[model samples]
Structures are given as structure tokens and as C-alpha cells.
Target: MSKSFERFQRRKLISSYFSVTLSIALVLFLLGILGLLVLNTKKLADHFKEQIAISVFFKDTAKQVEIDELQKSLVMSEYTKSAVFVSKEEAAEQHSEEIGENFLEFLGYNPLKNSIDVNLNAAFVSTTQVDSIAAEIGKRSFVEEVSYDRPTISLLTENVRRIGLGILIASAVFTLIAVLLINSSIRLSIYSKRFIIKTMQMVGATKSFIRRPFIWTNIKLGVFGALLAIVALFGLLYYLDLNFPQLGVLQDLKMLAILFSGVFILGLLISLVSTYFATQRFLNLRTDDLYY
Candidate 1:
């Protein structure tokens, strides 16, 4: 071969390698994002559920001491994440602030009852659990009523379940697509060197000898791709933490570590497997089939 032709071949090889690396990085990046969503789905749901509180209103004759005792018991309960005692005056003030009017002034009496606002743990925020908790609390002698937005809890539970299932399904589909995408890129890369592979085989290169370099090179490609994807994923998390701090995207360090590690492993595993199978396909083909 002329030096110019060899140079052309070299450039083409480099170009194909670059494309494969980029393709792996892009697919892994998307998978990383989906993985993030999957890992944080429960957290997102819990945040909203925590916002919905169970209001335990006291009877008119209930004393502050009794209310305090009940509130303390609730705070110690496993289902309760937090419990705040709201006096009738405080409830009236909140209502007034919400409506932009002093209803107490218009009515000449404060009719609001003293209540304990109970924020439940995420696990107990569903409709049935909340109702059961409320019923259990209502049996208290000082408790007049135990109330929460049953309809809101029901809707939230349903929507969260649906959304979580949808995300899981999407993650599975995307994972398969990522495999196919990376596999195809690897196959195309290997296809370019099929003739060389056949030549080596003709010269008594064992299957392992023929496969070693391709597997190693693609493994490195996978590592580079995974690293690139990780960097992009970190950048995204940083942006989210900066702009949407409420999401607490960076709060869970352990889960983040697991996610990042999974990304790295997945990248390496997929690339190794794809490259092996792709090269094997060409290795098994006849020399005459190279034109196809």
C-alpha cells in the first residue's frame, strides 16, 4: 500500500474510534440521567407527601396539657416524621393570612380549635395508612377530630405509583436501546478491520490472539466513555443543586456514589460484551463475505 493510502486508512481508523467513544459517552450519559430519576423517585414522592399533614383538632374542653401530651406521643410515633402543636390563635392567624382577612374580627370569636399538625413518614402517607393513623389518634379522649385531605392523599398516592412505574418501564427500554446502540457502534468499528482480522487468521492467529487487541481497545473506549458520561452527570447535578435546591439532588451522598459506580461498571461491561460479540461475528464469517 502507498504511504498516502496507509495514512488515509489511519485517519479513518482514528475517526471511527472517536465516533465510537462519543457514541458510548452519549448513551451512558442518558442512562445515567435515567438512573438518577429512578434512584430519586421515592425521595421526590416523599418530599411531597411530607408536605401533607394530618391535623388533629382538639375538643373545646381539651386542656393545653392534654394537647401537649398527645402531640408528644405523636412526635415519638414511628409514623410521625414531625408534629407541631398549633394553638387556636395560631390557626386563626394562619387562616387570616391565607384569606387576607381577620375572620375572628368579623365573627367576634375565635372558633378555630387547637390542633397538632402531624407530618407522617413517607411510608405512612398513603390514603389507607393515613386513615388508619387518624382513626387511632381520634380515639384519644381530648381529640375532637382527626382530619386530613383524604382525596389529596389518594390522588398523590396513585399519581406517584403511576409515575414510578412509568419511569421504571422507560428505564428498562432505554437500557436495552443503549445496549443495541453501543453494540452497533462496536460492530461497525470492527467491520472496518474485518479483512485484517481474516488475514491474521490465515497466518495462524488463534481466536484469542485475534480477539485480544479489539477487546482491550474497546474496553479502554468504554472507560473513557463512562468517565465522560460521569463528568456530564456531575455537571447536571451541580446545576440542579444550584438552581433547584429544594430537590436536594446532592444531599444523598451514598446513593450518588452507588449511581456513579453503576454507571462506570455498566459502561465497562457493555463495551466489553459488545466488542467481544461483534468481533466474533466477523471472525466467524467467510473471507468472501467481507464485501457485504
Candidate 2:
């Protein structure tokens, strides 16, 4: 009968430890996901910004040699990602395909001008930067006009700023919540062992001597929990990369390393701090208070 009771107590203690560790692991996994999004925000924004292009139309009187030279210059510019020259004939064909009619046939002439479509680097995709570049290009003698979607650029910039700010704020709030959750889990785990703690104190054990084992054990559990979270985080990232290759989810190894390291350190720090305080709480309690 004594052996049976001992077995039950041991099983209960193991179950409690497992529950606490699993809870910590789940919380850290969620925090890891938020960190990933924060790190990749700039990369995602740049990908979209690179898609919009500026079109520089040429005057009919402009010589082909001069037009080609201008396109070459634009391609070589620091601000340009790429530049493609489209002749009037090619533009007319593309327009006809789009509108499902050969407007050239109806008008008896092609109205499109030869132009260079310049895709700017993500850094220069803002409305002001684009306007400055376009103005400079419009001053060229061979250029008839420089045009792009100004409203789209402006709106994208504003939306990206707002979203980045929102994510940062959310990250801050989640971090605080994670700490509180981990601390609560540690406190609860310690609570179950309050009687053992008071007994050690009554047996003339020093507080530090009592705390060393509990602190060490909890820290080890924190490490295990952090490792579990990291494994899950990596698994999720791998799944995302495999299924959605275009998202390039795992492209930045350095950021991922930093994020994972942060999770491990956070786990260790929170565990150490919470364990110290929890043990201190029980240590300070009177023997009479222990019953309550």
C-alpha cells in the first residue's frame, strides 16, 4: 500500500513538470512566430515595391541611337533595377492585345511612342523619389514624357509604414504577455512544492542551499522547453517554404538564428528570475502561513 502511494505521488509530480514545460514551449513558439514576421517586414515590403515601373516615352523626332543610349544609361543607374526598351510597333501590338482591337487599324496609324520601362530599386520606389527621377529624365531632349502610377506608390508607402508600426507595437505587447505567462507557470510549479520548501527550511537548511536545486531544475526545464519551441518553429518554417516557395520564408538565415537565440535566452532568463522569486516567497512564509 505504501509503495502504491509512492508510485502515485511520483507520477503526479512528473505530470505537473510535463504540463509546465509544455505550456512554456507553446508560449515561446508563438513568440518565435511574431519575431519572424518582425524580421521579414522590410523584405516583404521591398518585394512589392520592385514591381512598379516608370515609363519614359520618346519624341518621334528622337534618333534611335539617342533613345538606345538613354535606355542604357537608365539601366546602369544606381536607382534602377532594370530598364527595357519597347519600340512603338511592339507597344502598339501589346495595346491591341489588351483592348482586343487593333486601334491602329481603325485610326490608320500607330499612336504609341517608343519608350523605356524602368523598374526602380525598392529603395527609390517612393512617390517623391520617383517624381525626382522622372523630372530629371523629362529634361532630356529625346524624352517626350516620364510617367508612373504616383497614387499607387504613395499609397503603398503609407500602408507599409502603418503596418510596420502596428507589428512593432504588437510584438512589444506579446513579449510582455509571454513573460507574465512563463512567470505564472513557474510560480504554479513551485506552489505545489511549498511544503517541501518549508520542511527544508525547518531542517536548518540555508535558503541558498534550498534554492540552488529548484533554480537549477527549473532552468533545465526552461532549456528543454525552449528547444522544443525552436524545433516547432523551424518545422513550421520548413513547411511554409516547401509549400509557398515564392514567399521565400527561410531565405534569411541570420535573422532566423538571432530569433531562435532570443527565444532560448528569454526562456532561461524568465525561468531563472521566476524561480528565484517563487522560492523567496515560500522561504519568507511562516510555518503557520504554510497551512493557509
Candidate 3:
């Protein structure tokens, strides 16, 4: 009966070890997902910054020479990426197609003024900078008005800033919660081995001697968890890229590599830190307190 009881205890210990390892792996995977979301948010914001365009409208009676001069000045501006002059007829046609109706017929003529469509450098796409550029452009003698979706630009800028802040705060909070939870799980796992720890203490085993094997075990568990999280992150990214080709631009080799590395490092760091703290707490527990 003693032999059977010993075998049953061994089996239970092995099962508990595996359970703790799996839980660590799951926590690492959650950290990886959070890292990916933060990195991708920045990448998506840059993509949007590159696509926003600015439009410059000319006066109704503005001459082609004045328009050409304005275009030249804009082209020479430091913030300008590219500027193209759109003749009155082309603008009218574009408006007609966009509105899905003959706006010229209702006006009895092409009331649309000639304009220049300007694409600014990505770095200058912010609301304040874009407004400054528009002011500079409006100072020209032939310029009638500088038109842009001001509210939309303001909203986008505000939203991106808010999202970035929110992500940072949430990531910090989640990381703290994750570490505490993981540490608690590890402590529970170690609690099951309290008898072994007590036996070592009773057998003249130094604290370092008792801890060495457990530290190595925890390291191995951490590496395994990090690896699992990396695999899961890559699988999710692959599916997203396959389903959403519009996001293909974000799949750049450098960005993907950075993201993968960041997630892997995050997993490894969280696991190691949680394990170290959990083991330390267990090592310091009094024999009397071990029951609790």
C-alpha cells in the first residue's frame, strides 16, 4: 500500500508540473498579442499619414500663368511631396462623377475653378503643420482659398493620440496583472512541492542548492512558453495578411521582424521575471507558513 501511494504521488507531481508549464505558456501568448497590437497601431497610423492629401483652390478668374506660378511656389516648398494642376474642365468632370449627377448642367456652365491637388510629405501631415502650410499657401496673390477636411484631420490626429495613450496605459496595466497572476500560479505549483523543499532543508541542503534545480526548471519552462507564444503570434499574423490584402503594406520584412522579435522578447522577459519572483517568495516562506 505504501508503494502504491508513492507511485500515485509521483504521478500527481508530474501532472501538476505540466499544468503549471501550460499556464505560463498561455500568459506569454497573451503578452505577445498585446505587443502585436501596439506595434501595428503605429504602423497603421504611418500608413494613413502618407495617404492624406491637401487641396488648393484658385480664384474664379485666375489666369493660367498665375496658377502656374502658384504651382511652382508650392513645388518648391519644403513640405510639398508633389503638386499637380487640375484644369477647370477636369475638376468639373471629377465633381460630376463624384456627385453622380451633371452639376455643370444645373449651373449652366463649368462653375468649378481650376485648382492644384497637393500631396504633402508624410512628416508634415499633422494638423498644426498642415494648417501652417495652408496659411503659407494662402498668402499667394492668386490663391482664392486653401481647402481641406480640417475637422477630419483634427479628429484623426486626436484619435491616434488617444489610441496610443490608451494602448500604452492598458499594456502597462495588463502586464502588471499578468505578472501577478503568473506569479500566483507558480507559487501554487511550488506549494505542492513544499514537502520536497522541507526535506532538502532538513537534509543540510543549502538554500542555493535547493534553488538551483528549480531555477533551471523555471528557465526551461520560460523558454518553452516563449516559443509557443511566438508560434501563435506568427500564425495569427499570417491569417490576417491572407484575409486582408489591404494590410499587405504593413507586412514589410523589417516591421514583421521587429514585431516578432518584440513579442518573443516580451514573452521571455515576463516569464523569467514572474518565475524569479515566485520562486523567491516560496524560498523565503517559513516552514510554519508553508501550510498557508
The most accurate candidate by lDDT is 1
Give per-residue CA lDDT, model 2, range 69-170, as digits (tens): 898888889999999999999999999999999998799988889999999999999988999999999999888899899999999999999999999999
- Candidate 1, clashing residue pairs? none
lDDT of all predictions: 0.93, 0.92, 0.78
Candidate number achieving the greatest TM-score relative to the actual structure? 1
lDDT of 3 by residue, 40-92 (tens): 79868766775677788888778888888888988998888889999889988
lDDT of 1 at 77: 94
RMSD of each: 1.3, 1.7, 2.8
Total clashing residue pairs per candidate?
0, 0, 0
What TM-score does model 3 achieve against the real structure? 0.86
Worst lDDT window (10 residues) for model 3?
A: 263-272
lDDT of 1 by residue, 42-115 (tens): 98899999999999999999988888888889989999999998889999999999999999879999999988
Give lDDT: candidate 1, residue 66: 87
TM-score of each prediction? 0.97, 0.93, 0.86
lDDT leaderboard ranking: 1, 2, 3
